[model samples]
Target chain A: MDKNLEKKVINYGEAIYEATYQEMQRDNNVFAYGLGADDPKGHYGTTKDLHLKFGKNRCFDTPLSEDGMTGVGIGAAMAGLRPIFIHQRMDFLLLCMNQIVNMASKMRYISSGEHCVPLVIRVAIGRSWGQGAQHSQALQSFFMHIPGLKVIAPTTPHDAKGGLIASIRDNNPVIYIEHRMLYKNAGYVPTNSFEIEIGKGRVLKDGNDITIVGVSHTVEDSLRASELLKSVGVNAEVIDPISLSPIDYEIIRNSVMKTKKLLVVDNGWTRCGFSSEIITDVAINCEKITCERLGFADCPCPTTPSLEKHFYPNPSSIAKLANRMCGGNIDWSPPEVVQHEILSFKGPF
Target chain B: MKNQFDIKKAYYLFLLIRKSEEKIIELYNSDKIKSPVHLSIGQEAIAVGVSLALSKSDIIFSNYRGHAHFIAREANLDKMWAELYGKSRGTARGKGGSMHLNDISKNFMPTSAIVTSAIPEAVGYAFALKYKKKNSVVICYHGEGATDEGVFWESLNFASLHDLPIIFICENNRYAIYSHQNTRSINDPIVSRAISFGIDAERISGNSTEEFFKATIRCKEKIKNNSKPQLLECMTSRWQDHVGVTQPELSKEEENNIKKAIKHDDLKNLENKLSKDEVLHIKKRVNKEIEHAIKFAEASDFPRSSELLENVYY
Candidate 1:
C-alpha cells in the first residue's frame, strides 16, 4: 500500500515461485524439493526453473515416496537446514500423515525445545475438471486440528508470496495450502520480499450489514458476493483468514460484533470442517448473533459439471445467503457470472 | 588393527551399558522411573561397536530400545537417569522419557517410539550433511521389524539414489513385540534386501563386539569415502520383553537358547581379554557412576506444571 514501494502484477503461482526463489537466494540452508520439483511442469509452475537456478543440490525432484521424503525433510530441518517439500495435490498428503502428524509436528515438543522442524509442506487444493475423489481434497481442517502445525491458505498473489516466506522462516512445521483454481488469478505483489505475520487475517473488503468470512478460493467468491450485495443495499464485510490453524478470531469477532450476522464459506465439507470452527469461535465470543455456514455438500465430489456446480457454493449463492441474513428477499437471485479463472481452466493437470 | 587403548575403552563402554541396564531391571519394580522401558540387554554389542567405530562428529538416530545407543555415545549419565525418572533436569527436560532420549551435543538425535519412523529422518540428515559438504556420516539404528513398513524401503531407495553418507544398522533381535520375525517376514535376509536397493550391505553376528566393530568401521569408511549408504543386519537376541522389565516365559528350547546366548555374552568375552585387576577397576568405576546417577535422578524435581506447553512451538 506504500506509494513509493515498487510492485508487479503476478499470478498466485508466480508469486509462490518468486518467494521460493528469493528465500533460497537469501539463505543457503533453505532448499526446495518434491516429486515434480524439477519436472518441466514444475508442480503447476510454482517450482518452475528452481532446479536450474538453485542447482540440483538445493532444488531437485524426489521419488514417489511421500512418507519417507517427508521424514527426510523433517530430519534435514532438525539438522540446521530448511526444506520446502512440495506435494502436487493435497489429496496425496494422506500417504505421509505419519511423518507430518507423529514426527514433524511433535519434534519440538518431544525434544523439549532442543530441536525444531522448520519444514514447509506446500500442497495445492484441487477443484473443477474430472479430478474426482482422490485427486481433489481441501483438508486444511485436518492439519489445523493438530496443535504443533501452522496451516495457511493464501488467496491472493500478495499473501501467497508473503505467507510462504513467513512459513519458511518459522521454526514450526507449516502446511502451506494453495488452491489450484487461484493460480491464474493475478494481483499486485511487492517486488521486495516480505512476510505476512502468521495467524493473521485481512479485511479484503469492508462493509457493515453482514460479516462474510471465506477460506482459500472461497475468499474470491465472498468478494464477488460482496459486490452483488452492494447492488441490493446489503453492505457485506468480506474477510480472508489466510492462516487456518492459529486463526485470527479477533478480526472476525470485531466484524461480527458490528454486523451482528455471520456467514462462513469454506472450500471443503461443512461437517467438522473449517467453517464449523469459525462459527463456533464467533458464537462463543459474541452475543445475539445469527450465523450460517456453506461448503461442499456432505458427499463425495461428483465429476460432472452440473453436479459439481451444485456441490460447490459460488458468488450468487453466497450473495443470496448474505441478502437473506440482512433481511432482504430470500427468493431474489443475482445474475450468474462465471469466474474468469474457472472458464479459462484448460484441463486436469 | 585394534590398539590396546581402544580395546580397553571399548570394553569399558560395553561393561558400562550392561551394568546400566541391569541397574534399570533392578530399580524398575520400585516405581521411581515412570516410563515404559525397552531394555537393550542382549543387543549391547551392536551399539557399543558402532558407537566406538564412528568419529566424535558423526551422528546417530536410534529407535525406542535406545538405552545401549545412548550409553555407548557417552552422553551425560546423570541427565539420562533424570530423564528416565521424569525429572526436570533431564535431557529433553523430562518430556521425552526412556524411548525419546536425545543428547544433541553428543549428536545422538532423538529416538522415536513408532517403528521405522526415524529412517527417512536419518536419510534427510545425511542429505543435509552432504548438501553442506560436511565430512560426517549418520548411523541409523532400528529393529528388523522396521523393515516391515513401506517407508523403510522408500528411505533405502532414496538414500541409494542420492548416494547419501549413511549407515543403516538393523538390530535383528527377531521379535516384534510378541510375534517372531519368521511369522512377520519370509526367511529372506535383510542384507540382500539392502543390496537390492544398490547399497553395499552385509550380515554379521551381533554377539561379537569385535566383528561388529570391524564391520561398522568398514561401512563408515565406505560411506565417507564413496559418499554412499551401507547397511549392516546384525543378528542378535533380546533377553527381555518388548517393553517393561518383565521377562517373558520361555519353553524348554527357548530356555536353552537363552542360556547359550548368555554363555556367549560379548561383555564376558571382552572381560576375558582384560586382566582381573583391570576388570575389577572398570566394574567399580561403572558401579560408582550408576550410583551417582541414581542419586541425582532421585534428587531432581519434576518439571513445573506451568512449563507443560513451553516447547510445543519454537
Candidate 2:
C-alpha cells in the first residue's frame, strides 16, 4: 500500500456508485439500466445520480421484464456496448435464468469466440426484516456451477469498488453479488479507480489452529468469530473467497494444509451450496484435514426475527463451530454482537 | 416499388434460398451433416424481401429456421454449409451447428434456437444503435409461435417504450411443430397484439416477395424517421416438417392450401418477368455456387478433440 495514496472511508453502496460513475465517465460504450435505475433510491444508492451524470440514454430505467431486459443486456454487450444491469434482489435472477445461463453464458462458446458478452449483472442479497424467501437469497453457488460466468461477492467497500470495475472491463459476463447488509458498513477505500483480481482470496486474519473461510457477508461474521476464538486461545485464520466461480482453491488449500482444520461459513444453504463445493475441493486436495460447513438450514427463510436469528449463522455460532473443530470446549457461548446494518435496515423496498 | 435490377436481384436471392434448402433435403439422408435442420422452403420471400430492403450496414437477428435469412444476407455459403456439416472451418467452428449461425462481417447477428430469445436482443442492439446515433437498423425474424412467449410481449413493450429502431417480422406459417395456430392461439390477429403494444404493425397476406419488400422499405423509412420499432406479420406456409427433411402429413384442406401456395410461388411470379435465358443463367449460377459450397464443407476437417474446451470463455 502506498502511504501517499489518498483514501476515504466509504460504504459498500457508495463505493459501487463511485465505480459506476468512474467507469461510465471513462468509457463511452458503458451504460447502466434496470427497473429502478433512475428512481430516487437508485437501487439502494448504488446507482445514485448516475442517470443525472450520464443522461437517460446511458443510465435509464427499464420495464419489469427480467428475461427480456436480460436478453437486451446480452445483445447490447454483443453489439460492442458494456451494460451494467442492476437487479434490486438476487432472488429475481431466477426469472432470467434462461437468458443468463443459456444465452449470456453460452454466447462466447456458441459463437466460437466471434462474439463476447461484456455484461455486468449487479444483484443485491437481502437479509433481515421479513424479506422472506423470494426477496432474500445469496445464490452465488448457482452461478458458480455455471461454466461461462464469472461470479464475485465482495464484502468490503474497497473490494466492492475494485471488483465492480474489473467486472465491467471483463469481456465475459460477470455475476456480481452484493449483500445489502454490507452496504452501510464503511471501510477505507482508495479515492482513485482500481480493480482487484476476480479469482483471488484475502486473509483477513492469519492464525494456525483453524482455517475459517467465509463467503460474502459471512466474511465479516468470520472476522468477528476470529476475535472470540482468540480469547479462547484458538488462533483462527479467516479467509474471504471473493470470487465464487473460478474460486481461489489454492488459498483455501494452503490455509487448510497449515491449520489441518477447515470450517466454511457460507451465506447460502449448505446442501448443494458453495460451502459444500469448498469442502469437497479441499478434501480432495488436502490430507488429514477436518472439514465442517455452516449455512442456512435447509428450509425457506422465515420472516420472524426470532426464527431468522436461529436461521442465520452469526459470530458466536461461527466461533463455537470453529472451537469445536479445533477440539476445544464448544459449550462456551460468547456475548452476542448486534450488527449495526441490521438495526439500520428498514426494508420492504 | 424497387427498380428492375433490384427486383431481379431479390428474385435471385429467393431462388437461391429455395434451391439451397432443397439441396439440404437431398443430402440429409447421407448422414454427413450431423445437425438437425429447420428448413424455410416456403418462407424464403420474407427473408429475401427484408434483406433487400435493408442497407448493407443494417443488422439481422433470426430464429432457428434461419437458413433463408442467412442466405438472403449473402453471407458465406461455404461457412453455412460447413456449419451444418460440423466442420472446423464453419462459422462457429462447428460448435453451434444449425440452430446457431452468425456472420459478423455481414452484420447478421447469431440466430437463437429458443423462441422469443432473439427478440429482446434485437431491441437491445437497436437501443445501442440509437444511443450511439448510428443510422443502422435491426430486423428480427421469428415465427408466430414466438408471440406466445411472454418475453415476446415484454420485448415489444420495451421497444415501443424506448422507440428503438427495429422491425419485428413474424413469419406466421400457421404451425408450431405439429400444433396449428388455431390450436395455439385465439382468433385475434398477431398484428393486433403488436398494435396493442403501441407499435405500427400490419399483416402481409400471402408469400408475395414484392409486397414484403415494399412493406419492409416502408417500415424501414418509418423506423428511421420516427426512431420507433414496427412489426410485420407475414402469413406464409411451411412446406415441410418443423425439423429434418421429411415432408409433414397434412389434412386434405391443408394439402389443398399447400397446392395453392405452390401454384402462386413467388419465384415463378418473378420468373415470368424475366427472359428464359436470364432465368437459365441465374439457375446455373446458383447451382454452381451450391455445388462449390457442398464440396467445401465435405472437404473440411472436423474440429480437433482438444478444441472442445476452447472458446468456452473469453
Candidate 3:
C-alpha cells in the first residue's frame, strides 16, 4: 500500500520542479526568482517553465547583482511573501554574506518576532569540467555554522520535492543546497503536495557490520559502495541525512549502536567540516565505534581530467575505505579508471 | 507644501540632534558607552526637513550615521540612548547597538552599518509594499561612501525597473573618512547616474530645510500618483569626525573649510524663519529632553547574560 502511494518515477530535478510548481500553485504569495530562473535551462531544469506557468511577475530572472538581489528577496520575504531565491553556483553566495547573515537571519530576532522572513534560498554546487576553483566550492559547513539558518540537502528525488515544500512553508530563512549531479538520478516520488519533516535522516540500506552515512550526492555514492561491499562479504549500512543543521543525531546514534562502527562522508572539505563534527559525535556518543572520514582534499580542486581523477573520491574509493575498516581481507582492487568526458562533473559542485 | 510645514518642530528636531550628538561626544571619553557612534553634527537639516514630508506609515532604512534620521522620525530618545548604552530595554533589545537602531512600530527599521546594504533592502521593502498594493513607500538614507558599492547601482536599477515606491536620500557630506568628494568620485554629478536609470534625480543644499522639504514632498507625490523611484542628493557637512567624538583629521585647507562652514551654525538657517523667543524655547525644551534621555539611559541596566541566546532565532 505504501509503495502504491509513491509509484511514479521522477528525476531529482523534476521533483524539485514539481515541488516548486505545486508550492506556487498552493500559495499565491509564494514566488521564485533568481539568476537564470527564466532561462532555457531553468537552472538545470529545476525551474523550467515556471515563468511560463506562473506569470513573469511570479517567476523571473535577475541581474548579476547577487548581494542587492538577495537583500531584495529578504525584504520581500519579511513582508509576507515566500521568495525562493536561487543562485546557479553556490560560490556566488559569497558576495552576499551580509545579506544572508546580518539582514535575513536577524530580521525576525531584532524585530522581536513581529516580522517573519519566509525565504527559501536555493544554491547549486558544481564539481567538474575544469570549472576551476572559483565554481567548485561547497560552503555548506560555513552556512550551517551561522545561527538562524536551516540547511537542507536532499539526496533522492522523493526527498527533493518534500524538502523544498517544507523549506518554502517554513517561517524562517532556509538554505537549500542542491547537488547538480543528483538532478539526473531518478527514483520513485509522489505527485501530491506532501512534506518531509525537516531535520531528519533515513537509513537507505541496513547492515550489521558497518554504518556509512553521507549527505546529498555522497549518499548516492555510498549506496553504490554498499552494493560493492556486499559482493566482498561485507555488510555495509547506508544513511542519507536530509538536513545538516538541527542534524538528527538520534538516527545516526541508533545506527551506530546496531553496527558498532561508523564512517562519515561529506560533500565538502573535512577540515572544520561536517565530517569532523560526525567524528566528534561518535567519540562522545558511541566510544567503542571504529570510525573514518571522507571528503575533498584540503586544497583547491584542479581543472584537468587527469588532475581531477585524483582530486575527488568515487564509489570505488569509498568502498576501499570501508573495506579497510571491516577487516582488510576483502579483494577491494581499484577499478580501471574510466576516462570520463572532461566535462562530466568532478561532482556540478 | 503649504503653511503645514512647522517651523517650531523643524527647529526643535535640529536642536534635538545637535544636542544629542554633542552629548554623545562629551560622554565618549567616559567608559559608560563603548559602542561606536557616527555623529551628524552638521547635517541635521536634511533629515529634519525630509521627515516632515514622510507619513508615519512610511518605512525607512538608514546607514551608519542615522542618529539624526531617527531623531527626525521622533524615535523614543530614551530607548535610542539606552540602545547605544546596551541596555536591555533599548531598541532591538540591546542586540543591535548604535549601528542598527530601529523602531518597527514607527516603521523605522534598524539601519545596517554595512555600506550600501540598506539600499537594496529598501528597494525590496518598497517592492513588497507594491506587491501588496499598499500605498506606503520606503525611504532609504545612505552616505556618499555607499555610492561606491555595486549594490547601490543594482538597487537603483531594480527600483526603477519595477517602478517601486522608493525615494533614495543620499547624504553627500563629501568626505568618506577623510577622502574628499573630488578625490573619490568621478567628474560627473552623482544625480546624473541615478537619472540614467530612468528615475528623477535632484541635488539640494543639505542645510536648506525649505528646499529639502519641497523636494521630498514632490517625490512623495510622484510616488503616489505613479510608482517611480526617486533620488535626492543633499550636499551637507559633518562638524565632527566619523565614528567617534574626536575632531576630524584633514588637510589644512579642508579643515579650514569645514571649520568655516561649522562656524556658520546649523541654527542660523532655522533662525532665519523663527523668532528669537521661539528659538530659545525650542532649545530649552530640546535640551531638557536630551538630558532626561541621558539620565534614563545611564540608569538602565545592561542586557542580562542569560538572554544572550534569546534573539539568535525567532
Models ranked on lDDT: 1, 2, 3
Residue A169 CA error for candidate 2 (Å)? 0.7
lDDT of 3 by residue, B1-314 (tens): 24367778888888898889888888888867758899998888889888988887899888779899999999888989988888876787677778888887778886887788878888888988987889888889998788888889999998898999999999888888878778877867789998999878999963677678888998998887895689999888888888788887788887887877777765676777888898888888998999899888889888788877776655
All candidates: TM-score: 0.98, 0.98, 0.93
Tens-place lDDT digits, model 3, residues A1-349 = 5653756899998999999999999998889899889999898888898889888888998888889999999888866788999998889999989899988888766655557678899998876777668887889998888888888999998999999999999988899999866778788888687899889999999899899999787897788788778777889889888899868888898998888888898888898998887878878988688989898887888887678767776778888889889887656684533323223544444
Which of the numbered candidates is closest to the native, going by highest DockQ? 1
Backbone clashes in model 2, listed as residue pairs: none
DockQ category of candidate 1: high
Model 3 chain A: lowest-lDDT 10 consecutive positions: A336-345
TM-score of chain B of each: 0.97, 0.97, 0.96
lDDT of 2 at A169: 99
* Interface RMSD, candidates in the order listed: 0.7, 0.8, 1.6
- What does TM-score give for chain A of every model? 0.98, 0.98, 0.94
What fraction of native interface contacts is shared by candidate 3? 0.58
DockQ winner, 1 or 2: 1
- What lDDT does candidate 2 reach at residue A328? 86
TM-score of chain B taken alone, candidate 1: 0.97
Q: Tens digits of per-residue lDDT for model 1 on A6-71? A: 899999999999999999999999999999899999988888888888898888988999999999
Q: Tell me the TM-score that candidate 3 gets on chain A alone.
A: 0.94
Residue-wise C-alpha lDDT for candidate 2, range B1-314, written one tens digit per residue: 24323767877898889999999989999998889999998888899888888888899999789999999999999999999999998989899989999999999888888888888889889888888899888899999999889999999999999889889999999899989888988988998879989999989997998889888998988886885689999999999999999989999999999999999988898889988888899999999999999999999999999999998889
